[model samples]
Target chain A: MSLDNEQVQHIALLARLRLADDELGETVEKLSRIVDFVDQLAAAPTDDVVPMAHPLNAVQRLRPDAVTEPDDRDHLQQNAAAVSDGLYLVPKVIE
Target chain B: MKGQWEVVIGLEIHTQLATVSKIFSGAATAYGAAPNTQACLVDLGYPGTLPVLNREVVRMAAMFGLAVNATIAPRSVFARKNYFYPDLPKGYQISQYELPIVAGGELFIAGDDGAQKRIGITRAHLEEDAGKSIHEGFDRQSGIDLNRAGTPLLEIVSEPDLRSAREAVAYMRKIHSIVRYLGISDGNMQEGSFRCDANVSVRPRGQEKLGTRAELKNLNSFRFVERAINFEIERQIDVLEDGGEVVQETRLYDADRDETRSMRSKEEANDYRYFPDPDLLPVEIDAAWVEELRSALPELPDAKRERFVAQYELKPDDAEILTASRALADYYEAAVSAGSGAPQAVGNWVIGDLTGALNRDGLDIAESKVAAEQLAGLVDRIADNTISGKIAKEVFDAMWAGEGSADEIIAARGLKQITDTSAIEAIVDKVIAANPGQVAEYQAGKDKLIGFFVGQVMKETQGKANPGVVNQMLKAKLAG
Candidate 1:
């Protein structure tokens, strides 16, 4: 379950993060701890234990495939950092 | 140079519950809301903000369990699924582990070989949704939309009982239909309202041990899920045959490229350090609430399909398609009731012209321009010989454009059926007189010439003449 330096670097690149050289050593330690914890589950005797699907035996209730909500234009634009009329605005480069 | 192989496929589907509010908060579970507007501070996971479990979500999870014929636990716990994403404001998702709301149910999927195979329902649990991360929209940095952050979702995990892509898609469709029929999820794929992920692995035939499984994520459409799974299965098979091993990881489906690329290794449950959410209490439901929800459920898809076949005398194939959506089934029944004891005619109109119009206009059955009663009135006109089938089609087209009731449109456009015998007889007589050369030809033992006279009568009546009446009168005249 232990990960080497190269494997740690590869995982970081795959996850879309930038880590410092010092942080790499630290991440390796934390990640290994996490992996070791998950590995404990492999031995908890699942041979006779059926995986749980749902907690209850009731059928899932449904709603009419009806459109229940209206499009909220004002509410949609309320949190915009910038707004112009009905549209959202952001920084522009070329005119 | 060949070793035998067997493929083991399982599906993990995330179905959003049809609840009015988010799973843990009172924010309206509305899609397409303003970013972060639907989110409350609790959903943002602010310090000191406690999470409260929505009782309705638990009831929904329980109902889904019952529908799948799964077992229910008297007590279920929620745990935090730790993950880091911009859209996930909590930095972790509230999900189920160790104890889920429902467990050990199976869905019977129809196999291609005219038999059924039961896909084991490993677990069905209630969970809160993560916020949306919009990777597009004019920037390198992704925007975070939390409108869906607290929305309640029921994740149904299925065992790797599926053997083929077809079975996987069939299972998905059945689940989609069941949820829709139960009023659980809108099951809309376009808005990411109903989504699923697939786990695929391969093993040698007759082997009991499992293989390294790769999980495919963000499949928004049924077609993509099927294609992605099929492609992944084939890819794994190729890798194994070439002496390569399939690594366990999380894969992202690039729909544009139609391939699944490895994102990262799959995380185990403990990766999140799934501890019970301290803010929320464990969910508990009494028998009374369960019975109430059960009574409120409409006739599900399978029962409705059976009734359509038995009561309406529709073929199984036709009934399956018509009752696939509850809206269409309701529309069909309304039209039949309006037709007044003519179920077959009603079925034809709904399945044929009405559905065609709906598709052409890009509308769902519930959004059709023609009401069910209007369609009934139109069918009655045909039954009473007020209009021929050919003209009924024309009237249906007009009605679909919101031109009012069939009678109103017929009266306004003068498209009523020509049922008067004398009126039709006059056309027949005029045709007989005008076509003397052809009549002479008919009398010279051209007994098959009745169709010629019928055509003339139709032209004289401007295609409104009842073909039945016209043919009868023409036969008598030509015989003499």
Candidate 2:
């Protein structure tokens, strides 16, 4: 129901984000408060209720397996930081 | 290999669905395009882009479920497997987590000990593939090709029933055959259409507890699957033999070195915090629709192999080989029915020369230059004694070269069997008369000399002599 500084730091790490040492306390408190608010739902008696994938009672909409999207690489790559040979370049990943 | 240690292997095969577009987007899924041309806004992980399920992929997953005798889950949920990778633009792969599309299936594979062994399918879940990380030709950076992103993939996880690397490959091959038969996947490993990751562990012969497992990744080929599992098993056993504990980790199989190494340090390794994605709802498949897909599925490998053995009177091994692929089995059956060739002989032709030619020319059975009826024509010639078995190979070669039909080729090349008894007798007589010293040697109790005379007769007839009739006539004449 609550989170610790270390747990929040690990969560940040998994999300590929960094929480500064000075900002860690505030972030952990905010995350813990948010978790506690959501955790209240677990206190309710709902043993007979079916688990839901979404709050809405609707099923996923399916699309026909057809190619309708056009080449939007140029438009999309305008937002990227780097590009080469039509490939989006990033920092070296593999060791 | 299996020795004092018992190796248990399980495989997770990622089969790229043969859908025309990406699983969640309308972007094209064609491979090897102009890098990012096929990638769209949704595939590029732009904010506010949502994924919609592709109907064809759901149908394909159900078909595979039925083919493997698995249960198609009526309600399947998608989850986000959170990870950080440059190739995965979304930073989280949308995959099935708690509930999957297909579950509790079993596939029968040829066991390493030469028996049919049943391998359990734990589950098969639909997921999106990550883009390619082009590490080559980049200095201190990696290039990302988003064309592969959002492509549909069915991650089939198998239970650890395989006892050896051979069994693992056999199971992988069986799954490959099923997917290909269902037309759900092209199953092309070279182009990354099909990929496999194996979890291998070793145990003592009588040990009930399994050893620590190392999940081996990047095994894209069947041979690599077998070799990687074998190498990982040996590595584990070696660690145990030296009194060192086998560490649980993800390992990468180095195809160049033929060994597996730990992919990342345990400290920084991936811990995928999987949760239901809020953007997508549960996919509800109707039981009747599953039945409809079942009716549409082609005869699976096992059923086809059994039918081949019964209908064609073929040996089990031969039937197995002939029914390795639906196209191959269909070709064999078509060849058998379209003409008067015996089913067994036609099966042999399809499994032998046809397969040989397909392999030699790097052609799929569907791309075979020779049609089934054409091959059946050649088989019919052999069956009817119009051409000796030896000469049929020549006819087959000519047919492969687009020369013409068997009858046309035989007529044009004068390659027909010398079936007329008198004509064949004349050649046999000429051969005996021309080789008198060998004939004298044949009469002097050299029984093998009949082969010499038969060869001479075949040469005289230009290999057109019916081999069976030549043998009988040669035996009778050489008896004197």
Identify the candidate with maximal lDDT. Answer: 2
Model 1 Cα lDDT, one tens digit per residue, B314-376: 988788788888888999998888776778888888888888888888998878899999999
lDDT of candidates 1 onward, in order? 0.79, 0.89
What lDDT tens digits, residue by residue, belong to model 2 across residues B210-310? 88888998999999888888788778888888889998889999999999988665565457989899888999999899889888888789999999888
Task: List candidate 2 segments past 4 Å from native.
Answer: A53-56
What is the CAPRI rating of model 2's predicted complex? high
Report per-candidate DockQ.
Answer: 0.08, 0.82
Clashing pairs in 2: none
DockQ of 1: 0.08
Residue B210 in candidate 1 has what lDDT? 90
Score residue B251 of candidate 1 by CA lDDT: 89
